[model samples]
Target chain A: MTPETARRKMTGTWSAHSPLTDVPAAVDTELAAFFRARHADYDDIDPVVADAVGALELFVTGGGKRLRPVFAWAGLRAALEGGGGSLTAPTGPGDVLRAVSSLEFIQACALIHDDIIDQSDTRRGRPTTHRRFSALHSERGWTGDPARYGESQAILVGDLSFSWADDMFADSGVDAAALTRARQPWRKMRTEVIAGQMLDIALENSGSEDPGAALKVDVYKTAAYTVERPLHLGAALGDADARTVSLLRKVGREIGVAFQLEDDHLGVFGDPAVTGKESGDDLRSGKRTWLLMCALDRADRSDPAAASRLRTGIGAVETDAEIDELRQIIVDSGAAEQNSARVRELTSDAVDTLRSCHLASPFVDELVALAEQLTERRS
Target chain B: MTPETARRKMTGTWSAHSPLTDVPAAVDTELAAFFRARHADYDDIDPVVADAVGALELFVTGGGKRLRPVFAWAGLRAALEGGGGSLTAPTGPGDVLRAVSSLEFIQACALIHDDIIDQSDTRRGRPTTHRRFSALHSERGWTGDPARYGESQAILVGDLSFSWADDMFADSGVDAAALTRARQPWRKMRTEVIAGQMLDIALENSGSEDPGAALKVDVYKTAAYTVERPLHLGAALGDADARTVSLLRKVGREIGVAFQLEDDHLGVFGDPAVTGKESGDDLRSGKRTWLLMCALDRADRSDPAAASRLRTGIGAVETDAEIDELRQIIVDSGAAEQNSARVRELTSDAVDTLRSCHLASPFVDELVALAEQLTERRS
Candidate 1:
């Protein structure tokens, strides 16, 4: 079938301001086929390779909100239809789906490596990559240190995922010129995420409590990497003009920050059952989230004793009582209410920017809906 | 200047059977410029990022044989001129230099990550990437474990290098179509090298005594990764035909194995001053090199006592006396002689294959010279 008809059929399921559910489903389908083929290739090389790829496949297709791919899809539609371009000979929806699906591999590489760096034992409630490999080493009664073997294999696996992400994108069957265009943002995204990671460790080690420092981390680690760049990459793929790209980035930045704020809020206040993680873990770890910074700042100005108590509590709180006490202090200092208000304001500003811009229809509407879903969700 | 004229000038310094000194020098120059620009870009982001990139710059430009880039250059030359392609409108020599220089970044990533895996303290007589960062952490009196901080930073730096390698190759100013053509082998090469690394670690941990298994490690770890794929990538970049690419890979695989065998030989016997490392270090570490396998195989067949002695000595030798005795046992068992003979046979066979093939010229001669230098070098 022609690309236009395929696109029409694909979009038929969507209604005004509805979630772009088809994008995530399409991305997952593409990833499944991609991994199956990769599995065969790795098996050809060695069973050891196949094992590594299998772990990566599970981590990639296992669970994700597919946020990056959704944004990329919206950006493409925004450019081809919203940016006043006729839908003449647009890149095929299938090809776009395949290309954006490659983003999941990038996410896989990032999280796998990040877990090793953070010593995070679990992700999405499953054993993190290194931990999984460590368990394998123990189960098989392998020689040498199991932890060392696990970390080493995880490093290689992460490296493999990073390489595969590039290969998958390049071979996503997009036109050569369009692929070249998309490469600009794709390349920048990889570097930014890694650099952001470096910044994170540095911040932790330096004991920097500056909220600005934490926000800078969020801008690079989340705002640009998660939202702005994904949109830019899709826009580039669609051959969108510079103005539209800039506006989308601005909108993306706001939405991304709001999404991150909501996540930080959940890390502190959300239900453990709903989020699938213990709330206050961030407080116990003394992660320099913006929410914590806000709380500290407000309490320091208004009530020095409470601020001191909060400071001592971070990275030291163990019992539920201590965590609850810290949570009360944040709420009493008005930081919790402020954080929620900020999320709402950011979402509103992003929608305002989208509405003011001359960007095309259904995409602008879809992005607004995505923004709400991301920032307003409880868990 | 025009590409043909530039090519003539570049090749003017070469003499038949002489080292391609120009290739390494050219690659280093390109890498120097590349890193300088990347350094600035990172600086623009944040000081922490700038610091990370600085460390990568030092490690990447520090030292190595630049073997991969040289082979890639030879392969490209072979395909363009030796594969009977006319000199008309060849890729600019400068662009080719920049493109091949990207391989050093891959090598950098491999060695940096490998050092972390091996817990190696030094590389090329300098602190390894992780150690360098670890030193910085201690000197700065950073919080948390210095070792963890160092390893985490190194992982990110290695990741950055890997990402930069792709960007450098993609933006090498090569024609878009040729870039697309190069992507196939380039993608495969990345996967193969990482997979090869996985195989290497598995072999070490499995405690397998089979020489065939050792040979399999050499094939993937050394032959395909270090040699065959570099040549294939270069040939693909030059748009060489399938037959020519196949012939080049055959030559590459043979030469690659011989080079690795030479390295193994040097690791055990070459002078520390010459090879810049302690002899028998590999033996002390009990690395499963082909030479070790050969020693075990022959000793097991004829002299069970000698084989047992060798087995017990590995991973346990500490004093100089123990290492000397083990080396003596290897030499007396004739495994050392067998290894040297195999290296010679492999080199001879590779040259013969090149001579028998109907592939293009000057490159054939140049590759033969490279094979001799690689396999016959004392260090």
Candidate 2:
């Protein structure tokens, strides 16, 4: 079979209506090749260094939705739809794939650092990097505090991933001119994401009862980073016009926020088996997410005691019963309904924007389908 | 005075013999302008993020030897001397200065993360970034574990510095073509440094009694990162030919290793007034330095009991008396003398290499003087 036909065959086996089609497989293939090359390089370094590289490779390849790269590829395809003959097509598929796949390294950096911040024990049903390294210390009966050793190693590993991201992006085999075009959005994405993460940490500590505050965090930390900026990077690489880039940004922001809202909902309410995360994980961590903020807002209006409980419960060590009670308050206070309504509204807005863009037919259809999958998924 | 004459004047009065002269000030000026711009951007984002940015700015500006940037500038100057007019001069002094100054940010990233791993309380006579952030958590009475919060914030701060380093280096006003030339060494420096850091962490935990292991870590972690790669990067930016770059790399490696050996001596034996660090701090932290390794090896030969004691004492929590005992073993075993001799040999070898390179007169003289200062300094 031809490459395109083989790709279709691989993706076709997924559920009949999946919008991602061959994108996830293609991205994974790119990432796998990238890691294989890196592993070879590290193997020549030393066993210990090689082990650190292996950990990073495992974390990056183990499990992820490949959402950012998917969005980037979709953006590239959408931009190519318009007959702007002035803008040259990307020289080869390999370059575009390499460029987009670099997003996974950025994501790995964020997740590794985030796990440390959240003191998370597991990610994607596996030990977090810090925890894994901590276990290594224990297994070896090494000197010093095992916990500190693990955390330190994880920090270095995360840093290596950050450096590798830039290296891979710059070396992505894209022409120099196209790489230059992609740099601005890449830089912006990095700065904004870190700033957004800082805001998340600060707000979680502040215990502020402001929904807008949480939404701002979502916009900066999630919306721009998870979707909008990646799309912009792809559009830039594709040499899209300013107007098209702006339009893609709008659609991406709406969908990205909607995606995160769904995540918040699932964090507290979704089945552990389905979500692959413990129920109420966010509530336990006291993450200042919009869903929790909406619940607190409703609690203040009608149930001061519930609001007070939430205020005290946040960032506090909580029992299973307390977690359930917090979940109950969110559902009982109409906050859950409000959050769901917002998700629907944002997702619809995103679809409408995409429709108005008059992008190429099948790719636009895929984007709209992807939007629905993002906002309405159970896991 | 004219610009050239003004520069000469600035270099003329520095203790009559200091090799660095005005390079530190020039680098600091470039860094200050960069931070000023970043602080403005962060201030617009949020107060908390602004505070993080302020902390980073203070750390970068606070105090450092500026060795990496100095060496880079010296390399640039030396490369320019070989009138292989094929190699272009930098566009302007501003661009070259900015590019070199970006090295400071990389140093900051390393120090911040190193401080966290070592659980260091102070840096440059101020609370380290993690400690400072921890204090903020406690002062604000924020809920949850304050130490973890502090460490998490510091991790993000370090990551931000890493990102800013790349961003600043890219926007350093260097011509794009020249910047491209520099990217490979820049990338190599990042990867090697982190790999070296990993090796350091691993060896420290392994309880391995191998001096070779410690030296290996020093070569990767300190030597190449602190000197060789920066010199290579500067030479690349100057568009030096392969031979010139390789020659500089050898000089850099020798001097870098010697510099770290001196640092190892200073960490244990230097006066607090001069070093700004408590004596025996390395012993207390159980750092597996070359000095300590030499002491262990000598102890094995002449005093097995002392060797056993040193092994047991290395990673143990130590009181003042215990630290003193550890320090005595290192000195009494003649490890201190051995380490010093190694430093002398390496420094002499480095100077000999520089002598043979036939670099431009004044710049080569400065490099030789710098090598002596690095190896002979008490602090």
Predicted model with the maximum DockQ: 1
Candidate 1 deviant stretches above 4 angstroms:
A1-19, A84-91, B1-19, B86-90
Cα lDDT of model 2 by residue, A1-379, tens digit:
3376356546643221224456666667767788898888776778888889899989988866788888887767766776131235444555776788888998899999999888788887789999999999999888768888888899999999999988888888777777778878898899889989988988877667789889989998999998999989988888877888888899899998999999999988888888877778788877788888888888999999998888778656367798888888899899899999999999999898777776766778888998899899999
Per-residue alpha-carbon lDDT of model 1 for B107-188, expressed as tens digits?
A: 8899899999999998877888899889988998888899999999999899999999998998888778778778877888
Indicate the residue-level lDDT of B4 in model 1. Answer: 41
Task: Kindly report which residue stretches of model 2 are placed more than 4 angstroms away from their true locations once superposed.
Answer: A1-20, A83-90, A309-325, B1-20, B83-90, B312-328
TM-score of each model, in listed order: 0.94, 0.92
Per residue, candidate 2 scores C-alpha lDDT tens digits across B254-337 of: 899999999988888888889877767788777888888889889999999988899888767468788888888888999999
Clashing pairs in 2: none
Please give, for residues A1-379, the per-residue lDDT of candidate 1 as tens digits: 3344346446753221223666776677678889989887777777778889999998999968899988887778777766633222444656766888899988888999999998989988789989988898889888888888889999999999889888778888778888888888898888988888888888889877788888888888998899999998888888888888888898888899899989988888888878877778788888888888989999999999999999999989989899999999999999999899989998999999997788765667777888999999887
Q: Residue B158 of candidate 1: its Cα lDDT?
A: 94
Every candidate's DockQ is 0.83, 0.72
Could you tell me the lDDT of residue A184 within candidate 1?
Answer: 82
**Docking quality tier of model 1:** high
